[model samples]
Target: MNGGAVLLPYRSNRPWLSGRDRKRIAQVLVLVLLVLVAAAVPQGPAWAGANLIANPGLERVDVGGFPVCWEKSGWGDQSFTFGLTGPGHTGANAMQITLATSPNGDRKAMMLENPSCAPNVTPGHQYDLSVWYTTTTANTVMTMFRHDVAQGWVYWTDLATLAVTPAWTQKTVRTPQVPADTDQIAWGVTIYGVGTLKTDDYAMEDVTAPATGTACSAGDACVKGVWQVLPFNSPVRGLHTVVLKNGNVLLVAGSGNDPDAFAAGTFTTAVYQPTTGTFINVPTPADLFCAGHVQLPDGRVLIMGGNKAYPAADGSHGYEGLKDSYVFDPATNSYSRVNDMTAGSWYPSATVLGNGDVISLGGLGEDSSGTVATQYFSQAQQRWLGLGEAHQTWNFWGLYPSMILMQDGRLFYTGSHVFGNGLPGTGSSIYDYDANTITPVSGLQNKDQRDQSMSVLLPPAQDQKVITMGGGNIDSNPDANRLTDVIDLKQANPTYTAGPLLPTGTLTGGIPQTTHQGKMYVSAVLLPDGKVFETGGGLHNRADPVYEASMYDPATNTFTAGMAVDPVPRTYHSSAFLLPDGRVMAVGDNPGNGSFDMRLSVYSPPYLFKGARPQILGLSSAEWAYGSTRVVTVDGPILKAELIRPEAVTHSSDPNQRFVDLPMSVSGNTIGLNLTSNPNIAPPGWYMLFVVGTNGVPSVAQWVHVG
Candidate 1:
């Protein structure tokens, strides 16, 4: 109708349209308008979600010269200054915080505590929180606080530990399900060290709905796997975790990084039975914290060296190592004293040789200097070798070095270690115990920054390849690197070559992330499927927990990203190992804040959710010699078999851990597995023998002794 005029019929005094006709016309016009609006708007689920944060750009400031709806918060005795800065991630302003002397505390710029500024959240829903930032410090965490209706604003869990970003970079993390009675949340980036931090463009969106269908799928659990945080907490701090032959987990917490505990002699140990979900406390004999441990041929755990004394509070003296050693008999759940080492050792590397003896190397001595004496443990005599018998290389291998046992009986140090600048030479070397010589290996990138990095012997053991992944320097306080280096010891001149980068989580603004913001304290567990499940780590020395994980397939030398992430922050002292049921269990996290997280989380690989798991009906024998053939009776057809050496992991180093592939010839439900002839490949120890079905599912492991 032009000019809003209603036309009338020629013979009628009434309007041109009837009542019903007018109504139909109005409906048609409404439909057309809606179609136009829909066309102008974005389509699909992309338009459904939105950022819930208010004053996210930090452009609006109050009279106090701080970002409106955000506040400066911190604790402990620290000197800091907070204000607004220019050239924000998106707007003209960003928040800035400087810590001049953060000896005991931390600082952050967080959302205001009031209801109007906080982001409203639905209980049980997850939100993706992201922020753009630049920081001179390596220690930062995405801290959160929740509004509890009755208790006002209360502290929530920290989401992710952010990497050091000298340049403008986006850090994103997904929160766990909102706890009940929580109506809103506030978050901020925290700087816990002496440095400067600038942050802007904060975003929080409800990702619960979309994640329900995509983050993890009921149909795709076999590919994505699933992580579940257990309901109960571990009784011990779990600084050291060993998968016992009886299928129980031995948790050792000697002193547990607690100076007060060391003073009080409150060392602790516990045996956790996964099947029953029960714990049996064991009386610890010494302060076994920072000790070296490995499984003996008879299945006893040899624990050596630990904190003999704590460092002085005023820095006059450093931590002293202990020469005391003990053997834990799982059968009795007790520790028995053994002969002391030649020198005190803290954070030593223990490797079990093919002959069943152990070589203990590296670590700080009683004087707090690197111990140069290479100690030997004679399994037959059950005593440490005397000084005359000990090999004195006079070389410090650094703390908790990843000393892998090669086929030729030489030890290969992967250059992956914890704390301090890397040693002289190439940062990696081959040590011949008999000749008392150390030959440096080359091509380990950024070796000094490899503190708490992980080194894994890629399965099958016959391949003789090791991969070192992600590390940072805690003492120097540098940004962690996402460098993966692989070395083929089988080569004539074995050297490290760059491997795939560690997978990272999502970023904000569709910004292209060129490299993986690497992390330290990463735990790599070898799964029955022949893939390594790499989980939990931190960015700084032991502070910012990195939330990245993946499945590394050795067969293809590639990483399958997008695996389920463990919700718990696994940083310093965290450990992960494969369980007998084919799942992976992660435990322990001691952040720099002096807090210990006893929470334990278990990850069930995608193979578990695929089809029916293969069953081991019977076995010809429980003992197999090298090169022997054993018959395994299964309930269904099996495609392959493997013998995985049980894990005795601590400080992310387990040189004794390896997977020996058992070549199998299957006929119906009967399978004949040919064990490896090489003792160095299989080692002399108890192993978890697993049979895989044609459907890719593995059976509950059966315990077998290999010698």
Candidate 2:
């Protein structure tokens, strides 16, 4: 001992070892205890975080130098290198990016983006970013670029500069609270001069914190999900509406009653995302004005026909027809130009076929009536083919007519249609897709009663009943037809029989009028609740635009006034559709040509505020085949199931919207349903699948593909 202190021995009763030995033994015991404690405690994602980016190792390259599921900047300011020297963080290969100053005098920037693939990094989320990098210089600015759902691009505020070391180093940058709307995830690396940056094993992981919100109450109603007038109004009128499987509404107005918009080549396509309450402006490859669209089997939209821009002087004879077709792929969020159709079709109508093809017909062709030829878009060939002209017996294809695929692989044209003449040629018939033959529908008492009327296939579609409701001819002329017709195709012999008439809309019209007859140009939509919603229609085309709305209950075979009367007039070009959120969206009401107005109105059904709403929490598949059995998980009671065809509305024509009741049996919290094998019952394409609770409240829809 240096000073007065003496070396003290460890006071241990055991004499198995010397003082030094006892001390060493105690040290070993402490180490062992730490290891056991660590092993016993559960290690979750927060502890051993994994990379969220696909192909993170950069080991899998698809022909190009870039990795799969990654979008790279190809603007020459960015260059990528593969197969780096030595071992990468995870594999033999590593990716490198070098930036040189661009001619614009800015540092080169590159972003590796995976869009919409990543869930929103909402506010309650905390993320830690880890990456291995070897750069030629230090202080290279790296940034996290987030594509916000509402706002376009938002940065992390501060640039996370990588502190370069002499050798490769693993570095971690903890991000601040992730914004609520952060949707598309991207990482950007910016460099100055001729600097090279090698990157490997980049990871961004979510670290959850303690719950900070209210607990689920025993009785919270479903109307919490109510009608939200999307934060931004659509730039273009939603004349043609298609509900995308991803829950976004694809609104294509084309020219929007502006004939000059066609010649100007105005890009009138836009998409509204419900999640972020924002609108994304998408460029259109062609004018989709007055085009016919349907969701194809592969989840792509087959949009055929467009405005050739030939407005006639009389307004009744404008016949600018287009034959070109286009396909919008939701996967890429881009449109693909497809070949033209066999013949020109204007104000055309389309319906899905059992064979996964779409048969398009009827438009004011050069003849100013239904187009002569019946054209079908072949999914296999990805082009339109002629099924020859309409059967000589079939004439006067109205503007925006009603065509439905029947249970027997035949396509039925409900003699009822929106425009043109109101009888025979406008009459009902069945056409066989296999034989390419036409079979006329029979037992019709009032042949001309269907002009401008709407027809819908009753729910649980197995019944195969078609209901044709009120409309007028001439000037939407003669007064709206009060008599509603019901034709059951499955009945040994189908005929139009008096079912029920729409309640006098004028009863609720602010102006007291003597006539109780409904107006012409009514738009009908099949609700998830198995009821039919009828909106819009003027007493005489606009002399009396009925603002009141009515709902037809199939169970009661009666029409009852809706809880809320629409403030916006939906007379002529007026369109309404069932939104994925269970509310009804009524848009576009240009009572006449060039008078198109873009006042969008959303109506929340009585079911919304009725009681606690139901929720279709989880869907097993984004895509499923017809007759396929699916297990659906719900958060509430489901007494009935429905699959509504995604809609595309214009005039009185909605190419989509075939409401078919899905065969479902609820066992516990799971719903077991069989997708109808019959394509007519449900066509091959994306549909808004909903489950109705015992209280008549419907679950917010989950899009299901039934091909």
Candidate 3:
């Protein structure tokens, strides 16, 4: 609100006013008060805007269970109630929207909207939307949308992110110039996180402010970073995406997004060109919804396991694990069937071992008890090597457990997963792939976080830290947990302690009065600069409510807002990874009632917005040994050099994507970089080589194999 809060006088004896009288007086008083107090209104335009809402108060209840003159849609989850009995911010009645149980592991179940009757507005006018609200639980966000007849109701902006506070505070949402192509303007509000929120008075009108100042124009905001959406569309929804060694993107979504294609196991694949906005069709052998993927030492991608079929009668899928596997040959942009696993697997986690084989673990198996049997694909023999059965008691690591190979050749579990269909496997664990045994890791404060929580092998893999962020319960009334914890797996007693708070995104054009949205399903891609670009996640109530990407800085242990915003809403089953050119490709947005987004978006980081991107002039070899120093040349001043393990992501968790900082000494355009012999840090496979400049810019990646 431009003016200070007005404490409406309490008349005690004669406090009850007719609904009509109450709205009229409130509008008049507020307009007069704003004109007197707002000294910053722009000078060019005369203040002539009026309250466009039909009713500002909730005193008049309609037969349709909404306030008079207002219309609403969605599940029966809203009400206009009166006074202390109602939980309003003022007088007799206030509007309340409730969060209901969700329909699936990755679907939004609530949609309570209240819209104005298409208010008339002027062209080139700016407006402010204000409301007084308080909530019972944290991170309950209010959203607004603009109804474009052609595009339907598109998200216009977010107003505020409220926490669990008792006081009624006023929040404002200021929108840019109103579109001149629209016939009328309408706004609506809804709650995304958990809990209920009460609202009383509301207002929407034009205000004035000075436009002159030290303003930021084009080329200014790119000093740090920026995001620009490309002009082309990805042919297939990027349910599964990987950056190929050839600087192209390999996208996989087996199942042409037919309503029943996922259950029936459809195969649809393509290769996306980052340089040109075009897609080349590639075919897959089977649907890879719950499959595991890893880049091979020979620069191929091993795609293991996926959906077989789930009978439609049961309503909820039992996740029929598949015994089939395939290897994607980037050389031909095609897939080849490989040896099947010892047992059928769905949603398995795969990681490349020190010797070039892949250790595959967890996920629903043929018998569906978390598949006690484990297996590894021998790249040397082109056959499946059975590892016997894994930890029997801890088989419920759920799907895609945070399994990564350690420096000691042991597998460490971060106790996070894509699904929590059963009792969650709590705490971190160390598994000896040889002994087929498990040892509980101590000091982890956040256990039972197996439901879509994200765990990553932190930057400069040598650090040996696994950071896990945001997850929630599988139970009906689920809410996302904003817990960011890190554990030093190298420690004698590796335990997860608190790390930096996960970065929070603001509601579009809104204030920071509340924490916006939950943190489940946040996807991270390790950039060449050693920072993690994270975005897309579920809300507290299972809704995917975020579009703004954030970059995680390891040096300062904080996050800076992504310079660009992606328009797509990528929720559960979505994937993001850094392209060889330093751009980010985001895909997959599964909303569970059989809705899958086949559309994908790419994010050109701020570096792309600057001058011509730096170039990796040359490298001695594409392959390097465990411990060796190599000479590389760049076209620009080299600030740092890093090796990022190429990642294959599914269900928001990528077993790869670790950052290994190369010890570097620069000499003009030439640089010498050192590689560590520790397989636990660098692993044995191909990585994306990047050279960062002092200007915070990065060179396009080149393929570098570490063994």
User: lDDT for every model?
Assistant: 0.81, 0.64, 0.65
Error of 3 at 233 (Å): 3.0
The candidate with the higher lDDT, 1 or 2, is 1
Query: Could you say which candidate leads in lDDT?
Result: 1
Candidate 3 Cα errors over 4 Å, as ranges: 1-220, 256-259, 262-265, 311-317, 387-394, 421-425, 443-446, 506-513, 540-542, 561-563, 609-612
Segments in model 1 whose C-alpha atoms lie over 4 Å from true places: 1-217, 506-516
Clashes of each: 1, 6, 12
| Candidate 1, run of 10 with poorest lDDT | 1-10
Residue 653's lDDT within candidate 2 is 68
Best-performing candidate as measured by TM-score: 1
lDDT of 1 by residue, 497-540 (tens): 98998887522232333464777888999888778999888767
TM-score between model 2 and native: 0.64
> What is the alpha-carbon lDDT of model 3 when measured against the actual structure?
0.65
- As a TM-score, model 1 comes out at 0.68
